[model samples]
Target: MIGICKSFGANKVLGGVNLHVRPGEVHALMGENGAGKSTLMNILTGIHRADAGTIMVDGKEVTFKNNKDAEEHGIAFIHQELNIWPNLSVLENLFLMNQPKTRFGTIDFKKMREMAEAKCQEIGIDLPLDEIAGECSVGQQQMTEITRSLMLDAKTVIMDEPTAALTERETDRLFEVMKKLKNKGVSIIYISHRMEEVFANCDTITVMRDGQTISSRPTEETNMDQIVGDMVGRIMSEYYPARTNVPGDEIFRVEGFTQPGVFRDISFNLRKGEILGVAGLMGAGRTEIMRAIFGVDPHESGKLYFEGKEIHIKNPRDAIRHGFGFITENRKTEGLILDFSIERNIALPSEERLAQSHVINDKKEFDFSSELSKRLGVKAQDINLPASTLSGGNQQKVVIAKWVGMHPKLLILDEPTRGIDIGAKKDIYDLMNELTAKGVSIIMVSSELPEVIGMSDRILVIHEGRAAGIVEHKDATQTRIMTLATGGE
Candidate 1:
């Protein structure tokens, strides 16, 4: 794509952006969320039209009419959000519309199974063909999506944050697949926020900021500092800010939290002005425990104490009423209503407090949400715009802003910075410190060990649904936490 430009009304998303990907190369597209990487690819795949640009395939200018047209031209896009049908079987999902037909024109189940099994074996992935897609782990679902794209024999594959949901093992497998595809002369456009993955796996790196391409270089030639500087337009002297707030007395406690097969014997406590990091591998029951604690799910046996008083949290409303806030990991589905305006989303939880005599005060609601949005540094032209109009980083801020408006004594953040950029991550870290300084306790669950070490006053490692050990911030290291997270001493 050369000189690509796109605009959404007054918002110019991509401005003269240029990208070049070579055959058989793994090119990493680095950018903060909403930096036009996805927009450029969407143009390439015919999801959206560029106001002005040129797309040349094999030195020939071409235009794709739709995603299917792009696929037919050997270009496939695997979005950051995996598109999977929960009720369908893995095999069914794999060949949904493109299934083989028998001599009599009936669907050929045997042929589909054989082809799927062959593809799985070729990629070194083991998937249950008949199992419900929803029953599969997130990693499995991710692999299924990749396999679907590969089945089209796509020459150029655009993968957006493919490793966000994968475990270390799964990520390694994905890297191996990328290497194999490269050997076969297939180009991969890898879009991710994980700097380590980019430097280690990619052959080239391209950085975008504010809808424009800032720089592109071979992976070996550029360092992280330069790339980060290009991304955020400044040198980030500190990735994670220092915390000045000293933790006070215990504010919340969970004892013997059990949910039968999901999690067992989970015990932890949160102190006032503390940021407790929950560290564990994927599917280690970390998210499950958080959901149970927030009363979104049931726990067979557990005791929750708020301010030293026993509290029975039967639902999320109960937890919220008792000053608990939860920022769910899947923010797109659980955290905010996408169709609602940003102001509405920010004011959703605080309606009761912003009301008088069972009637909502519109001015009070708008003023309250607007204040919180600005405090969180939410970038938007108008708060009246739909929540879906903002970028991933800003959406996360809105989620946090809503919870902050409630004045929660304890907040639960599950993968708070999962799909956001480095600048946004720093912003959130700073916000956490600010909240803790004001005496609001936080329990942060994250897969990134570096984040846990950098932000947490105390790190709690969960191994196979059990608390392996708790390490103080001074004692927390990647090795120590990994050892504990994997059932080591």
Candidate 2:
């Protein structure tokens, strides 16, 4: 992308944004939320057209009329959100657009399978030739996505948060594959909010802030703190603040938490002023346990104790009745109603607090949402603006603020800071510390190991639906956590 300019109505999301990639290099796009990184990629991949720009592909300038044109031009964009159909077989999803067959009205299953097998072999994926895509794990699904791009001869592959849902070993495998691609002269444009990944795997780095390119430099020439400072143009003094409150009596406890084929025999406690962390790989039962506790998922056997008495939470309503709140992992879908106003989405769970005469109190609703929005530092055009219009980091803050207004005795956040920029992450860490200081016990589930170590007073490590081990604040080592996470415990 060079001299790119794009606007959504009056908002100039991309203003003269410029990026480039070499034939055998990984170019990383780093930015705070809403820095026009996605917008620029959208333009390049024909998801959106630039107001004015020129794209140089292999020393030739090109313009794509649409996504199909971009694909034909040898560019493939894997969105931050996975787009594969779960119910379809892997072969079908791989050759989704155009299938190989003889010139006949009937489908060609034999030739399609043959070609899919060849492609999967070249890409090092070992999924069954006819395995259902949905039944596979997230890491396998991502590999399918990558193989799909290669089958189309996508010379320049663009991956957006491809490893966000992957395990440590899976991430290592992905990096290895990317290195092979680099050696084969396949340029990759990697976009991610994870600074460590960018620094580790990318050759060049470009930082964007507020729809502008802040800086672009060679990875070896810059450090993490400098790049972070450039991305948000600030020096973050402290990330996770020290908690001020004393740990009180246990506010919530779960014993014998069990969900058939998911997780079983789990027990944990949340003190009134403690931040308890849950750490594990993807599908390791961290999220499952949280969902079961919050009554979002089914539980065959478990005992949930709130305050002191055991409560049977048949649904989310019962969880709420027991003063429970959850911030889901999939923020775009599970957390917020995108089309609704930020204020409206934030006020959704708290409507009962302001209802009078079988009617919602609009004034109180707006007031509460507005106050929380301000307190959480949610960046938005207005409270009435649609939640979809906000940036990723701001949207996350809105989600947190929504539940904070509910005043739950226990709040559970699953991957609360995924895909958010470092500045916003520090802000969130500060917010978490503040919440814990106020006697609001927190149960946070995060895959980022550093965050698990930094924020939690204690951590519960799970694997294959069982509690592997537990560690205190200062004693948890990444090596120890990984051992238990991979089933060593």
Candidate 3:
């Protein structure tokens, strides 16, 4: 990494950026979600410092005064939000901040569980070193934070979107532990927005646009439409829109839905200008059927409807007075309230829609949160800052413009562009085709699968919460939605 300029004040997020990784190949870097690839990996792990650039390492010229001086020069990282510490253990999160001592000074727990069970068997990470890293699964707490950065022998690791919440058999055991850390020569870097995990496990790639360094090639001659036409100069067919449909009636239904250990017999319907995607695999309940249809879990058995009536949502303020709006899938911990702003989290469900009818209109809630924050462009430096200071693709467009100023006819969303990037996933697929051309009615919940086969018109899939069938968005097929999202052939 060299000349990696950065800025937040005037927002030049890493403009002079340049990077190179080699030692034993991998490279990657990529772009799109707020470009600048996590500000050049938080300035190569010193956790933000480069107001300019120059880092070097192995060729020497380094500077990381933090992240334990970039893990004592071998560098480390992991982080696409998994920082670990879920009530510890997995051998205390693989040696919490480099432990191991005891010449009677104590704290070496049998040489850190014999080096975290021999570095979780040299990274194939099958778990169980005294368990409880929050009792596992989020792809085993992201491979125990990448096996606690190779038990501190790191040598340039990095990672970031490590299989955006995994499971294709846990991302083929993390590409067989990145091919045994590139046959032990080490280097990595990686970071991704998933062009099939940088063309199946990078051997170079780079890209990064808007914040500079437009190309770096050689993943066998760069392709994925030339790294998305050099990271969004366009041409990926104007960034995916096609999934057309014209269904209308049904509105929203869900019969027989149970929520026992999490799911069972769930059903579906969702029409009236529909979208519907859903697909599954990670705990296959597809975020517990959008948290049991937005009432936030309370489905011991179910049936819900709208156009044909039958409602009783019972909680998220009776599913926002039966209009419903969800968006969830961890947009900064269950969708924003982050120190509030961006027009006070887009005027908070208009405070129970104006404290239960009439009289709380601060200029019509700042003109309806400045007209849905300029119809969802939402950059920042106004609408009152905070929302934990924007940019994770503008904090996921302020969590879909905080439920699009709560108008909702039936939105639901869930994994809305999960870890964001491809130019903020094409401005969230042009704000879901302008909220399905304003008639509204979405349902989405996705684990990518080509974005539920490029924005559904009826896909469904699900598996352990039942309805494993639905298809027809022109007879979909990511191998038939991975054989109905894992119930298989």
Candidate 4:
């Protein structure tokens, strides 16, 4: 893509950007949130037409009318959000648009199964072809999407945060598959926030800032600090801000929280103004424990206390009534109604408060949403735009704003910065410090070890549905947390 320029209404997202990827090379795209990386890719894939640009494929100028046109040219995009049919089997999802048919005009189940198995083997994945796509793990679902692209004989594949939800083991397997593809002369455009993944896998790096390209270099010619500087347009001395609040009295406590086949005997305390970080490998039950505590998935047996008094939280409504708020891991699916406007999504949890005699006061709702959105630094031309129109980081801020409007004493954040950029991550960390200074207790579950170590006052490492141990911030190290997370002392 050359000279790609795009705009959403008055907002110019891409301004004459250029990108080039070599065949059989894994090209890494680095940028801060809202930096136009997604916009350029969308234009290339025909999701949106570039206001000004030219695309050349194999030295031949080409125009894509839609995603199908791009796909027909062997340009496949595996979006950050996996697209799969929950009710369909893995094989069915792989062949969703283009399925093999027998000579008699019947579905070729036998041939489909064989092809699915072969693709899984080629991708270094072990997945059950007959299993429902929703039942498969996140890693398996991601692999299934990649398999679909490969089946289309995609020559240039674009992967957006493919390992965002994968475990360390699963990520390793993905890297192996990427290498195999590279060896087979398939070029890949890889987008990710994790620096380690870029340095470990990608051969070349391209950095973008604001709406234009900043720099492009070989992986061996650049370092994380340099890349971050280019993406954020400054030197970042600290990844996390200093904790300013001293712990006060215990604000919330859970004892003997148990869920059959999930988390068991989970006990923890959240003191006033404390940021309690939870760390563990995937499937270690960190998210399960938080969901149970928030009453989204109530535990089989548990005792909850707020300020030394036992309380029963039968459901999420009950939990909310008790001054508890949860920002779920998957924001699109659980945290926000994408179709709703920003003001509506921000005021969703506090509808009753924005009502007068059961009738919503539009002025009050608008004022409250505006206040919270500004406080969270949500960048948008109008608060009436659909929530889906915002970038990933801004959408997360909307979710946080929604809960902040409720004025909850305790807030739970699950993978709060999973897919956002470095600048956005710093913004969230600063926001956490501000929230704690204002006396809001936080319980954060993160897959990133560095984030857990940097932001937490104390880290709780979980292993196999059990609490391995809690380490203080001063004592917490990546190695220590990994040891405990893997069932070591």
TM-score of each: 0.97, 0.94, 0.34, 0.97
Q: List model 4 lDDT by residue over 1-489, tens digit each.
A: 888988888888898899999999999998987888888888889889989989998899988999888999999999888799989998899998788999999999999989888887887777778899998877788878877887887889999998998889878888998898899999999999999999999999999998999999999999988999999999887888888789899988889999999989999888999999999999999998998888888689989999889999888999898888999998988999999999999999899999999999999999999999998888788999999989877899999999988998899999999888998899889988988899999999999999999999999899999999999999999999999999998
What is the descending lDDT order? 1, 4, 2, 3
**Number of the candidate with higher lDDT, 1 or 2:** 1
Q: State residue 420's C-alpha deviation in candidate 3, in Å.
A: 10
The CA lDDT at 230 in model 4 is 98
Q: Candidate 1 on 232-323: residue-level lDDT in tens?
A: 99999889998788999999998999999999999988899999999999989999999998889999998999998999999999999998
Can you tell me which runs of candidate 2 are displaced by over 4 Å?
128-136, 382-392
lDDT of 2 by residue, 371-403 (tens): 999988887778999998887678889999988
What lDDT score belongs to each candidate, Candidate 1 first?
A: 0.92, 0.85, 0.79, 0.91
Candidate 2, lDDT over the whole model: 0.85
Candidate 3 lDDT, 1-489, residue by residue in tens: 778787878867776888888887888888776677877887888888988778888777878877888888788888787777888777788778568899988797988888777777766557877878877777788877777787788777888888888877878888888888788989888877878877977898888887888889889986787788788787675557774547667877888878787788887788776888888788877887787778877787788878887887857878988778898876776788778777878778766665535566676677878888887777676887778777666777878887877878888887788777777777777777677777788888888878877778878888876778889887898998888777876
Query: What root-mean-square deviation over C-alphas does model 4 reach?
Result: 1.4
Clashing pairs in 1: none
